[model samples]
Target chain A: MKTQRSRGMTPAWAVAALAISAGMMVVTGCHKKTSTPPAAMAPTESAAAPTATISADPLSIDLGQAVVLNWRTTNASSVSIDGIGNVQVNGTQTVSPSSSTNFHLVAKGDGGTTDASVRVTVRVPVTPTAPSGEGDMGSDALFHSHVQDIFFDYDSYELRSDAQASVTAAAAYLNANPNIKVLIGGYCDDRGSAEFNITLGENRANAAKQALVAAGVPAGRIRVVSYGKERQFCTEETESCWQQNRRDQFSIDR
Target chain B: MKASRQGLVFTTFSTLLALSILPAAHGQDWNVLETGKSASASTRLAAADLKPTGGAADEAKHTFDATLYADLASAGLFDLVSKSQNPQATPGSQSEMNLGQWAAAPASAAYVAFGNFAAQNGKIVVNGFLDDAKNAQYPQIFTKLYNQDDSAEGARQAAHEFADDIILRLAGTAGIAETKIFYTKKDGLNKEIWMMDYDGANQHQLTHLGAISIGPRVSPDNSRIAFSTLDKNGFQIKVYSLLLGRIVAFSSVGGTNLSPAWAPSGQQLAFSSSRTGDPEIWVSDPAGSLAHRITSFAGPDVSPTWNPKTGAQIAWVSGRSGLPQIYIMDADGSGVIRLTDGGYASSPSWSPNGQFLAFAWDRKYGPGAPGGQDIYVMEIATKKWIQLTHDIGRCDFPSWSPDGRHVVFANDPDGRAEHTRVMSMLADGTQKRALTGAGADMPNWSWK
Candidate 1:
């Protein structure tokens, strides 16, 4: 061991000098037994303490938008972000937060541990003010809440008892707001051919329209379209999901 | 080979006269080339790379060769020889070709198709020829000259025309290489009409309506496309004029009107309308005038398709008896005959020969049943049906090619609309190929 150490002494000293200049204390241990003094270990132990800093680009974003968080650490052997778990010592990550969040980063090393954090503000979009004259009753939200979509049986367009009640309520709403026009879209589950479903959807829409008309809603006030199986309310293969899709949804024509 | 027997002609004029005379002479044997014939029974044909004459011709040569090869291979008439087995030499004329090499060894081609491409004065010219490799005495089958503007598309068009002529001379039927397929592609929440070459090239959007459009049926004259779309009024049938490059005004009959199908005569359209308080079959003029209700059934009658050959019968989907089924009626709505007794069937497209109807049918249409929606062809006279697509996907909207050899349809392999793709296959259900990436459906092949 002594002979091998003596033979590699010149290159080892060059590596130690380069390591010391670069502020890397780990490589100095390579030549420690040859010529290193005990006092040199003091600086190595003190430098073992880690320092970390984190920053977020823009620091604020609207809901649904993403913000980039970049972090850097010195002398740290391990690093992690609060929400993101473990991460590289220095890197950038993109995150979309639904609410305001503080990205906390922790760095740990032999000497000590250090932490830093950057807060990103997420701005929730404000809903636009509804047009005047209609009040809450005329708003689309209220209409959707009151009118409701009427479901149907598979391969059948006949209105059930529940569907008939929905039709009656929708007709009453249409009668109360005489100026409002309604468009009924019939949708089907993605089980059959799109062509057949198209006609089936039309049948459902027309059935709802006929019931509305029978309930004293003017036929001219309502228009019907069959979305068929093109648009789905739910896409699961389960019966419950498919039942949700086979329906006549009412919306404001305007 | 004798000097006089070398059938090489460079013509600067009378190109149309040559094309007219050649087909009349060689069109007798096309009936022997039937669909569903095994590849081993098909004529072994090889397409050589087009020899470029000028620097600019080199740029378009690759397109010409690839298009020509694809056209012939997809014709379902010939067993195409792969390029790897072809001889290295690209013969531009009969004098330059050595038939013995193509007939021997790896290629063993029965017939060889060779062409020369040139660019002159902003025009792309192709002199294409097919030769009987074994018959040195009368080797030439047909020689066609195609000239168009100097561009990659021009080269492709020239190739399509030349390949079509070759198919006509050899198979006795018109080739679909130069045809167009119109379909609906989803754009965000809206579906717009799109068009592509029959070989799935040159795909481009035709409509930017930002509204839902489906069921595009091209006119027999290829001048207009009739489709169903959603507007402020409701679901309506609109005619898009290809010549005008925009949607033309069609008189709407109010209520929900959808699925407009053109008669072979191109004068009348058959569609389903709810204007009379129920969805029924309606016949109208091309401009949606002179509209008259034909089917006064209790249930909805939709997706009307006319017998392309006779135009005397209209096959449609009717829901009069519980579930929707295929039914055929006379042009005036008399002589009603149910085609599919049970099972859900729709989108009945009549073959060009007027003998069969290709439609989408779910034979055992119930939850957890192994029978899924697939394309099927039903013989109207016999009521014997053959399932074309087995279980690859849920295939629908099967439209027959004008030659009655192929069917193009939409397939949803993953059971999602966003994953739907336009697919085409031989009428026998072989050679299935996806023509679009995804998010496309309701394919309508244009009538020649």
Candidate 2:
């Protein structure tokens, strides 16, 4: 082993035989092992065996803020985020959600696949300094930020219990703030025809106005306008999003 | 490919009228007789890109050609021959056309529309001609000369005018080309009134109110658009002057006002108002000099639409029966007769001839209803209605075209998305065409 440089003096025939055997072995070694790792199993059966949890660092975020998504998986060979691409089984991703977004994760493993989703809600920054016509803007701005909008069921103008409670609170507020005139803008989820939505929105708005009047606010002080589905609060195609769009926002118009 | 000879060809016009007086005589007979339904086979028609003979900018001719091609394609009656299939010849005038090529195989166009345009001296002079490809001698079936503003839009308008004439000459029905569709286009939270040509060309916002508005009914004379707008206080009927392009003087009915319908007389308007304690139909002169109640139903009554031809009869929705249904009566609320059965129905628009009523109806309105909201047309004489749309995404706000041959309506084609679009179809429910893309709603077709 130590006399390696002097191998040429050993034997010509021996070297030839050694080279032939080495060539045969090298030819057999050129088999090229598979380049593709087997496809990630879809985890069809008993997918519930694999559980995934996607937790946002902050459940809610300001419009421009970012949320760190930390996901952990058990028995998952591959993990994919809804807005984010495939990632390691356990990792964290930072996403700046402009609107309420659901981060859906599909966890795959030998047993099965599981679906887990986490929501990040975006809060629109209230602009108080924006020009809003007259000093009425002050009341409008304040009411917009503080007053709660009364929500309605789909295609229903009649007030629900929660809506009635909000209307009661609004009635008390209107009575206290005698100088402020409120405009009840009724809206609808972007369903149905706009024409009917006009009528539907009107009914909703008027329903709110009538409730306020019945609660002792002067009928003359309350103005109602139905934006219909025209002014959609949420354009997303989801029941929860649409529910947010169907509501009556109280604004001080004059 | 075998040529479809489904439409009746008027090749037997043995009497050749003098060329000088042909314009007056051209309106007598069309090649295709109206069968009151879609043709067994679509008419194979071709259009030559308008040749620019006048010294106008290139943009004018190109738009005129493009719009004319698109307008004809949208006519629904024609199986328009593609520009690539058509002969590379822009027939400048009717007399110069070679019909043999258009009638030949591969380009077996039953009819051909050719035109020439010139933008000169601040005016666009257009010469449009439609010819029967099978007729040798008197091949010219229709010809019209239009002088409009020497701008791109004006040129397109000129093209629309000529296309209307061609459609009239072929379909035996007046085209909606000259008419405008008044609709509301959604921009963010603001829905504003907008106007477009019948073919959805040249869509421009008519109101900058920066608010929500709907139910834009253009006056019969195209002078004003009566729309409902949300102002600071509440919703009111607002009139926008086409001549002035601004919100002009309109009746300010107290309380919430919506659904403004213009009378063909151009003297009156009918709308629904909640001012009288309950929603009711009210009519007033356009000037708002005074207003009178048209409906005094104890329950809610709304959505008044007038017969565009007579203006003497009006149809509206009444909820007095617990469920809304269409009811028609004299403009003064006399001789009231219900037009729809006991189902949820609204938005009744009368035909131009006052023979039929088109409205949105939910025939199976109850728990576990099987069908979606559909459009129905009722014959005034028999009180019988036929469903025009079936499960075509909550179709509503049915408005009739000026010719009475088609209906323009708002349909939410994409079911759950909540976005609706303007669509047009024949009165019998055939040839359904989407007139506007998503977000355009409540299309009210203008009268002739």
B1-448: candidate 2 lDDT, tens digit per residue = 1112111221111111111111222221112223232351447888988777745447878888888887777666677898888887768887668899889867899899887877777888888888888888878887888888978789788888888888877876777777888899887767889888777777888888887787898888889988888775466888899999788887675667778888889898898877765567899888655788888766557788887767789988876776677888899999899877776787888888777788888766644456577887766765644567766788888888887767898888767433788888866577788877888888888888
**Residue B430 local lDDT, model 2:** 71
Which residue window of length 10 is worst by lDDT in model 2 chain B?
Answer: B12-21
Model 2: CA > 4 A from native: A1-254, B1-46, B49-59, B77-96, B104-111, B115-126, B132-135, B142-144, B147-151, B170-172, B363-371, B390-392, B415-418
Tell me chain A's TM-score in each of the predictions: 0.47, 0.45
Error of 1 at B130 (Å): 1.2
lDDT by candidate, in order shown: 0.79, 0.72
For model 1, state the Cα shift of residue B403 in Å.
0.9
Please, what are the lDDT tens digits per residue for candidate 2 over residues A1-254? 01111101332233223212232234321211101111233234443345565566566766679988777777779989876889999899888865667677777776556656666655544443332323423445556554579888866778999988888877766665555688888888865445556666777788898898999999988778777676678888677887998899887765
Q: CA lDDT of B66 in candidate 2?
A: 87
| Model 1 C-alpha lDDT per residue in residues B1-448, reported as the tens digit of each score | 2222212111112010111111222222111112536432457899999888766456677888999998988877788899999999989998999999999979999999998888889888888999999899989988888998878888889999989888887777788999999999999999999999998989999988989898899999999999988876557898999999999988876777889999999999999888876789999999999999999978778999999989999999998997789999999999999989687898899988887789998877766677788898776775755677877878899998988888999999977768889999877677889999999999999998
Docking class of 1: acceptable
Error of 2 at A116 (Å): 61
